[model samples]
Target: MTDAFYDSHCRVQAEKMNDLAVSDPKQLVALSEQRYEAQIRNVCSYICNNMERSHIVLLAGPSASGKTTTAHKFRKMLKEEFYVNSYVVSLDDFYIDQCRLPTLPDGSKDLETVYALDIDCIHQCFDQLTNTRRASLPTFDFHTASRSIITNDITLGDHEILIVEGIHALNPLITEGLDASKFFRLFISVKGEYSLNNEVVLTHEDLRFIRRCVRDYYHRDSSLERTTGMWASVRAGEKKYISPYKCYANLTIDSLILYEPCIFHHFLCPLIEQMDPKCDIYPRFERLYHILQYFAEFDRHYVSEDSLLREFID
Candidate 1:
């Protein structure tokens, strides 16, 4: 879909969120739950209808687009609806060794590029899984920035599905020789924004940025400063590799939860407060903090532990 389509969709959803926040605050949790369940059911239906012919499912999206959680949820729903087995293979586990990664003009490792991964090995694994229904997959240790010595032996059972998720999963290079009909492609992203007093307070990318910052700090032990520093490179990689292949997806999911910003405020406020005023990203942090002022704080208790929002917060 075009940017205009998503912009309109986000606008309507933002308005709905505002109305719900004012009219029935207690129902926000239920509304969010229903919306999430509907999307899961929609994906499950697509898989059920196509299960006979599709063997591989490629789910790609930008950073912090809820890809991992979506894959897990889709797998759960598929098992419930069809009683079939599925394996989720993370492309992240195939990252090339740090020393061998391509260097950018500024001498920084360009980890976001598809070439940062071992494409030949990935192609072979895909071939093995599809033909022999089994393959040995490498596991990457993000902390050490190297591939682990141990590999996972993944096997697909009869009538099973193989889900490969990563930022570049839909890139043509990953499935070059595979039949297009044997694959189901999905592109998931946050496509909504919140407006206040007729002024746009946040954009779709802003929501994703917030998610990334929180997730990086809490889960990856990355500082906000480091996360902010890497964002430009991340967006550049998305533009070069991910965005161009979006049209190849058979389905697109907007992974935004309307109450996300409110929930994020609790975690981000303290982090933003800790930033030094003179730091390069302090101004950006201040702006984000200001935006949160327009949103009401949401109680974490209202959110289910399994919610996609949990992928980033708590």
Candidate 2:
């Protein structure tokens, strides 16, 4: 069953923010921070309650959904509030060697498929971690598009939590041999949108796309055009592989930061404006630009370095 907490929380938050005076950007930023912090605290409370019975956490989210940042924040909350340490295992590191990965008809690696991961190795590592509290974690080299020879030795403390996060963490194939009782599953995504006059102005997908575009431009050296071009494939992969398993999560997190669109406007507008008129992605760029016009710009300086927005906005 899908957890109703996040959906309810989003509805309440939207109402609260909408009721606020839109005249002051400072007030909006403060309110956004308050909502974001409360949501984080709620997630931490849920984790603490399950700490005694669950040692493993499987955190799954779609692209630009702030999975990495959420993992970091969860770790921080565990340390500060519960006095527990945690180990993070990235599923991206468990990808099968490039040569063995499944290829699309176009001869490109179909990296989105869960079969691209080395299932046997993951099961073995999880077995070692649960049985002996020790495991060697493999690291994937994105540049080389393969698993690296070097590995990190991780030993989980008696009170420590182990978090495994990726786009496919909730996939049955990855958790095939694992004990469901030993783990807590979480599904996160941007589940809110900006609306005006009963019309949806910006959708959750558009928000995530903005995040991905900003992050891709600065961190991955991907141009706005390239990010927009790849969006269809990303959404297709999510529909086929990710969305079906969302309801399996013990909890769901809405990763939307209400003030994000305003912040994104500062970073994304230039890139959107630069899109070639003749390019196929120009229409999407135009649509996003038009939607952004409804939001009042907020200063990014108010956002902390550790904020979830950092995962996408650099």
lDDT of 2 by residue, 1-314 (tens): 11221243333233334334256656666666666667767877887787777778899999999998888888888889878898777899999889999988889878788888888988888888777888998999988988898997888877888989999998887768777677788999998876665456778888898999999998999988788778888998999889999988988988887778778888888877877889877888898887776666667786767778988877
> Which lDDT value does model 1 have at 28?
73
Alpha carbon lDDT at 7, candidate 2: 42
What does candidate 2 score in Cα RMSD to the true structure? Answer: 3.6
Stretches of candidate 2 exceeding 4 Å from the true structure: 1-22
TM-score (all chains, Cα) for each model: 0.92, 0.91
lDDT for each of the candidates? Answer: 0.84, 0.80
In the range 227-249, model 1's lDDT, one tens digit per residue, is 99899999999999999999999
